[model samples]
Target: MKKHTIVALVQDRPGVLSRVIGLIRRRGFNIESLAVGHSETPGVSRMTIVIEWEDVEQVVKQLYRLIEVLKVSDVTDDPVVEREMTLIKIHAPGPKRPEIVALSEVFDAKIIDVGANTMVIEMTGSPAKVQNFIDVIRPYGIKEMMRTGRIAMVRGVRGHNAEEFVENANGHAERVPVMN
Candidate 1:
């Protein structure tokens, strides 16, 4: 019932993403947000997945069974820096441009482009901040808006690193996060 954010480091190859998605679908887990991109290491990809599931540990274990998946971590409980980017196009005429620009400044949003009657605002922040900005700009007649999937990185020294996934003497896999 609660949302869990799982980050997985997997081999970068064709069909690997589809395979992961298929596995999640077969298990009946609904993905709330999915963001995948290149990882720190070449030929490896990082996937940030948000799903509403209780058995997070089970899911992580299942993911490890997949050959492409190199590491998995449930970052829901970890202290993390989560961010999302949103671009909002608002109907801002000459008279309303100043007011809208001021409002965007208050939220640390940037006015990327301005046309005759519309302006595009770009912002990056937490989900709550993004929602608040949207709420405030709703009255201004939004022309269009788009948002990127959530991306996160754990705080402090302990994080989702390649070194975390270590092979034991017997050749079994184990994760040992370096604790501060």
Candidate 2:
């Protein structure tokens, strides 16, 4: 199977997320990472989804068919940028404090907080890079982890704007205006 990243714009209303997730589940596509946030438009949310699939084209078409989905694009085909944020808590004893601080500096991670025997670190980078950092600190005993998921956008062009979609006379397929 091949891995693909899909960026979708959808109505930012309640239950939209569940509907989108349900569609993926119904298709038996495993979502590796999903990030949802407000878009440039009000009442619209941009969702970045990463999944492993055998047929990406078919899945993208299906994703577009969802009612709440305003626009869907396979960002993997574009010169896009991606990033993920992670907060990790590690066991940092008095003796390990300096070592942990050095590791954090090496990885460009910030020490968010310091507890009696634990330190919280916040790191942001590409998924693989973040995983490498986690692996490097695994020996220190990770107590907890929280990730904000992956978010991406095309490098040059803004994707289809929701306001550009016009309902056809049949009210079925929305006509997307061409850009010149």
Candidate 3:
């Protein structure tokens, strides 16, 4: 089995997420991670999903068959930009405060809040980069953690454009403007 990342653009309607998840579960696919949020367009939500699949092509076709799914693309093979967000709270002694701050700076993370004995750090980056930051800060004692799953978009000149996306689905080949 190979790992694949798919970005699904769907109508932001109630029960849509549950229906999509149900399909995946019925197919016996393992979802590694899933993140859903609003897109630049109102009433549209983008779902970023990572899963292990035996055949990516079949999965993509199956997803497209769903009525509510507006667009489905397997971005794992594409040259795309990907990122994740993580928040970590750590117990910091007075003397260790400066050290922790420096580490966060090195990782380009922000110190969101500082208490008398703890500091909350927010970091956004690729998964490996975030894991490296977490590994380095674990020695200082992590008190809590929260993470937003991975989100991605295709990169460069060949990225999907809104009109092109619609036309492609409609058996037309005209270029269309990209929608965020």
* Tens digit of per-residue lDDT, candidate 1, span 6-31: 99998777898998888889878889
Q: Any residue pairs clashing in model 3, and if so which?
A: none
* Model 2, span 1-180: residue lDDT tens: 777899888876679899888888997778999999977666678899999877878877887788788888887878877899999999999999999999989989999999999999999988888999999998999999998889987886565456665445654335366697
lDDT (Cα) of model 2: 0.84
Distance from true position, residue 58, model 2, in Å? Answer: 1.5
lDDT of 3 by residue, 9-69 (tens): 8767789899888888998877888999976655567899999987878777887888777
Residue 166 displacement (Å), model 3: 10
Any idea what lDDT model 1 has? 0.86
lDDT (CA) per prediction:
0.86, 0.84, 0.84
Candidate 2: clashing pairs of residues: none
List pairs with backbone clashes in candidate 1. none
Off by over 4 Å in 1: 163-180
